[model samples]
Target: MEFSSSLTLLNSKTPFLLEKRILLLEAILEHGSISKAAKAVPMSYKSAWDAINSINNLCDNTVVLRETGGIGGGGASITEYGKNLIQSYTILQKEHTKFLEKLTTLTDFNSGNLKSLQRFTMQISARNQILAKIEAINIDKVNANIVLKTKSNQRLVSSISKNSIENLVLEKNKEVLAIFKSNNVMISTNNVKGFSARNKIKGLINKLTFSEVSCEVNILINDTDVITSVITTEAAKELELKIGQEVYAIIKSSDIMIGN
Candidate 1:
C-alpha cells in the first residue's frame, strides 16, 4: 500500500536525517555509550557508530560529547542541542502518526472498494500488529480463492480474484503486511502434536462417509458444539479420527466476525 502524506519525512531523500538515525542518537545519549545504545536496539556496534557519524555530519553542531580515557573511562553524552532535537522529533513523530491514522479512517469510511479499504487498515492479531496484503487471487463462477502470504511467511486463503491481484501488482517476495483479527484462525492438529495453541476444544467423530463422487467427513468437537467438516475422507482417516475418539477444534481469534 502507498504511504500517507504524513509519512513523507520517512521517505525523504536526506538519508542521514531519518527517524531511525535520530532514534539511535537519542538512544546513545540515554545509554551514555555507542555500545550500550547498540545493545538497546539489538544492532551491531559498527552500525551504531555509523549512524552516529551520519547524524553528526547532518547537523552543524556536534550532538554528542565523547570523553576519552580517565578514571571513569570513555563515555558518551548528548549535548543540549541533541536533547532539544530529540524532543522536537518525538513531538513531530506523534503528530505524524495521528494525522496518518485519521486519514486512513476517513479513507475507509468513504471507499466502496472493500478490499482496497482493508489494505489501508491497521489491525492487530495474535498479539502482533500488522497490515493486510491481498495477493494472487483466482476467481471462478462458483467461488474465488486468493493466496495471501504475510511478512512472517503466514499464508491465508480468501475469496477474491486474478484481476484484482494483478491490479494490486502482487509479486513473489514483495514486502506486504497481513492484517487479521486474532479470532479468524481455524486450528486443527492433524499432523502437529505438542503445539501450544490456546483454543483447542476436544470432540468425537459422529459420522464417516466416503464416496467416489465427493468425499465428506463430519467430526464432532463437542456434544452440543460446532462440527468440523472435511472434504476428503482420506484426510479424515489419516487424522486417526474414529466415532468415539477425541479431536481438537482450532479457531483463530481473527476468524470470528460479527455483522448485521
Candidate 2:
C-alpha cells in the first residue's frame, strides 16, 4: 500500500547515487543551458550546478561544456559522453518505471489471495497474543474501567481503578500489554520469593470487588497484564496497596485463556 525507492543492484561496486540527479542531467541536456534547464526542471541554478559537479566528479570525462560570451551568449551543452550517459539513463529510467508498474499489477493481482493465505497461516499457528492500544481510562474513587482498541479494530474492556490507574499514568493512546491468564492468577509479595513460572509478571493492586461470599482483586502491571481474581478485600488492603507498590503475578500457559 506504500511505495518507496526499490533500486537494488546486483553488483556491489556501484557508487551511491540519486535518481533525481539523472533526471536533472536529462533536463539540462534537453534545455541546452544551466538557467533554462533549472527552470525546466523547477530547480535552482545552484542545485543544478551542484548535481552537474557531482556527476563530473564521478565520471572520467566532463559531462557538460560551457562557453562564455559566445554569439548565443555564454550557454551550456552536453558533451558526447554526457549525451551517451543521458541516453543510457533514459533507457534505464523507462525500464524502471515499467518494472514498478508491473510490480503494482502483480501486487493487485494477488493481494486478496495473499491476505487469505496469511490468515490461514495465522490460524494454523494458533497465535493468541495481540497488541492493544489503550483508548480510554475511567477511574472512579473505588474502581477503574479501561477501554482498549486493538489494531484489528476489536474493543476490550478492563476494570481497574483510580489509585492504581494514576500510579501507572495510564493515558489515551498509551500502549498497554494485555495478557490473558487463566481464571486464577498467582499473586505474591516482593518478599515472597521463589517462582518456577517463566513470566513472573509484576503489578500493583488496582481494585477490589466484593460479593456476599467471594471477592475479586485486580492487579495492574506496567502496560501489560492486569491479573484479576476473587480475593478478600481485607487481604487486598493487607497487601498495603495504596496508589503504587510492587507485586508479582505468576502465570503459566495452562493458566492462560485464549479466544478468537
Query: Which candidate number maximizes lDDT?
Result: 2
lDDT of 2: 0.61
lDDT (10s digit) by residue, model 2, range 4-60: 453433325765345666667777778777777777777887787777787788778
User: Which pairs of residues clash in candidate 2, taking residues 3 or more apart in a chain or in different chains?
Assistant: 143-161, 144-160, 144-161, 177-223, 182-255, 215-231
Model 1 worst lDDT run, 10 consecutive residues? 251-260
In candidate 2, where is summed lDDT lowest over 10 consecutive residues?
251-260
lDDT of each: 0.55, 0.61
Error of 2 at 217 (Å): 22
Deviation (Å) of 256 in candidate 1: 37
Q: What is the lDDT of residue 13 in candidate 2?
A: 79
